[model samples]
Target: MDNYLLLKIAHSLPGLLLLLGLLAHIFMLWKANRGGDAAVLQRKLRRTRLISLPLLGVLALSLPVSGWVLVNLVGWPLGQTWLLASSVLFLAVLVLGLLLAGRLAAWQALAGSPAPASLLRFTAAYAGLIVVLLLAIMGLMGAKPA
Candidate 1:
């Protein structure tokens, strides 16, 4: 009904979707790789590169814009501790996301052959950190003083 409600929904929906998308990609890619069929894993990686990754990128990029608008809508000072903390965490998430993207590209490049375990490990660590940071940001957002 109101601008705040609409904006809040806009802000929240993408965050949830981004989380789910990351989890799904992790699971799907893991499954594909574990199946021990290089073609399946290659196809999965290519699909992720072509489709899911860009969608997730768009979702990730939309968050800060919506969050800024929502914060302004609520008239909350940007300097508040929780806001500051979440902002910092969001930056970390973005950085990790970029690193993860690079790793994914490397993985895709190696998809023709047997992928090395280290690349998967790094990607998993990055994704896991991103998930944890996102959850922390959600917690901070949910607990902000009214």
Candidate 2:
């Protein structure tokens, strides 16, 4: 009913959605790769590159804006240690996400050719790092002082 609650919901919802979307994308890509159908793999990669990735990017970008508003609403200073740590982690996630996108684009560019094992491993590792960073950020947010 209040501004804090409203802002909290706004900040939290997209974060949850983004995490879920990323996990889903990872599973989808893994499944497609395991299916051993080049056409399906390419289609999955293209769809993720063009549609899912962009939508997730928008959600990812919205988080800091909403989080800033929520923090201001709560009258918390921006320079708190947890906030700073989370910010660093968030930036790491963003950079890694972009790198992942580039790797996915390379996969898509293969146009149904079999993806290299090294490329697949690198992409998966990047995704794993992003997920870990995101989780760390969430933990920092949760552990912040009331």
Candidate 3:
């Protein structure tokens, strides 16, 4: 209806998409863990991971960019130390996400063919980090610029 609404919408849309994609990736990892043939599960995992790359990138960037814009344009003053800290943490999480994503992509591509136990362990650990990051991001978002 107005500029503030537009800004809030723009920022939240990307953030929500990113959150949704993260949830999807998380579920896929869980699926991989459940009953299934190792090789087939690996193939499916790789396919899902491969497709998630661009989506992750889009979410990773869009969330912060739009969020910052909205906060700057429509949100409260950044004087709140908690909000500022959360913003920094959110950025750190995004960077880690981007870096880990590249590593995960490379690993998925290589390990997709064989599906080693070690690789699955790696996926599990990496997936764990993703979950942590998502939780932190969600917390920071809920904190907002209060």
- Against the unseen true structure, what C-alpha lDDT does each candidate score? 0.92, 0.91, 0.66
Instruction: Give the alpha carbon lDDT tens digit for every residue of 1-146 in model 3.
Output: 99878877777676677767777876765676565556655676676656776776766777667766766775567767656776676766666676657656655566435546775576666656666766776776777544
Candidate 1: tens digits of C-alpha lDDT, residues 10-92:
99999999999999999998899889888888899888888998899899899999999999989988999999999999999
lDDT of 2: 0.91
Index of the highest-lDDT prediction: 1
Top TM-score: which candidate number? 2
Ranking by TM-score: 2, 1, 3
RMSD of each: 1.0, 0.8, 3.2
lDDT, candidate 2, 30-119, per-residue tens: 999999999999889988988999999999999999999888888899999999999989999999999999999988888888889999
lDDT winner between candidates 1 and 3: 1
Candidate 3, run of 10 with poorest lDDT: 106-115
Candidate 1: global Cα-lDDT? 0.92
Segments of candidate 3 deviating more than 4 angstroms: 33-35, 75-79, 106-118
In candidate 2, stretches whose alpha carbon ends up further than 4 angstroms from where it belongs are none
